[model samples]
Target: MTLFKTVDATELQARKTAAEEQFRGRKSGIDHFAGNDPVTGRPVGGYVEGGIEAVLVKYAEDLIPVYVEYTTKGYTLTSVGVVSINSSTWEIYMNRPAEQVKPLLDAILQKVEDDYIAEIEVYNNAIVDKAVAEQLAMAERREAKELEEATKARRERIESEVRQGLKAPDLTKPKSGKK
Candidate 1:
């Protein structure tokens, strides 16, 4: 039996879309700003004023997922999630029902939104930081691997030359004296 779970997808999608759009209405709730230096806690100037799109592409990459996971339970609406975040203005949108069983859901969702910002602040000063770190680490690893390969190739070339008598003038030196 296929358990066809029922949910108000319109509401869900509305909530989802609202969550994504929430950023646009909000202003600079982010301590620094997206598309700015993560470590230095720099500001993206007027970009935050323009909303998420004003920030760099990388910073906005995972925003949708974060908003989604923060709002939904197995089949119920745990949180409304973000309607939008307007950095330039520093506003947050949590468009939710006012007549639900727990009116606190709105407040709770707001708190969660605050917590989301807090969570991001815990690790970053600006947006795109974690992304930049990951990219840098990956690039470093690749460069290191390439350097290792180059070194290994150089060593092999030297060894081959020595073996073929094109190099090496002290191959007979038994300095360790192991008989």
Candidate 2:
């Protein structure tokens, strides 16, 4: 008989539907399309048909060129081989069933989410650093202005004291006899 368990058309369809449902739930976090449907005015759903390629187009468009290579041994397609997914320079080789497209898409989506979070963190840190630096500079300038004003006030006080001393009568001088 056959080495592998046979999968009927109905079973395959059910598996595909389940996979699509899983994808729909997971895609909510990263879904950028927030437009409403033209016909009903309701929000557009995020489900796309046509297997892995469709999922990639709808969700992971940026991570394009995610190649899936399926190999069949003979004319009857008895022996199905491994699936290779190449995303950019990184290559993932797995022996997963071709019908299970959700797991592969899930992995890519996870990567996208992680990278997005890291980018946001970096941006926030930069803004905080810039704000702190601006505050420090402003404080330094205020301190310098206060110091300059204090020095000027001290100099004016010393000058006024010297002028008062000069204007005062000399005690050692004798009075005029004619007075």
Candidate 3:
């Protein structure tokens, strides 16, 4: 069983206002209407009270583009502006002073760049050291091989001379056949 009653516009509006105030006083953050999601046509969370919605709309219209641009460029919003029904535009404030903030962010970026450059320098130095060590090792090997070849050549020449001296007549040794 269900009961239906018709209420006048003024009475209904008064009741809505009371309800919105009650809910807002008790709750925190944005209040969402059950079936009145602005973007989607479905029910979502709790309902947004009329006053909050108006303020939100005003802020979005004026500052949404600014917020989007800042965020797209990798910046964070530090503060939200005060909302007023009389004002046409919304004002947003930053958490940090512009003078202090810019230098801090720049310093951080500069430090990262410096660290990367230092790492590259270390890697380049390691490469140079490795190349020098390889060159020295190759030179030493070349010298050792040249010395071995020279020694072998000297030994062969000495053996050839001894054989020639033996084959030729020697005054100190007597001949096998008498002259």
Instruction: Return the top candidate by lDDT.
Output: 3
Residue-by-residue lDDT tens digits, candidate 1, 1-179: 52222344465556545754554344323434456667986766443321221221134545555445433521222243333354422212333322331343455446556655565565454445667898999999999999999999999998887877865556578677667
What CA root-mean-square deviation does each model show from the true structure?
20.9, 19.5, 27.1
For model 2, where is the 10-residue window of minimal lDDT? 73-82
Q: lDDT ranking from best to worst?
A: 3, 2, 1
The candidate with the higher lDDT, 2 or 3, is 3
Task: Check candidate 2 and list the clashing pairs.
Answer: none
lDDT of 3 by residue, 10-60 (tens): 654565455544433332234454455678776676633221112233554
Cα deviation of 127 in candidate 1 (Å)?
Answer: 4.5
Per-residue lDDT over 1-179 for candidate 2, one digit per residue giving the tens place of the 0 to 100 score: 63323335565556555655555433222233556789988776454322212122222433233333332311111122222244333222223344454566566555555655566667767777898999999999999999999999999999889879888776789988896
**Model 1: lowest-lDDT 10 consecutive positions:** 49-58
Clashes of each: 20, 0, 8
> Would you list the C-alpha lDDT of every candidate in the order shown?
0.48, 0.50, 0.54
Q: Which stretches in model 3 have alpha-carbon errors above 4 Å?
A: 1-95, 162-179
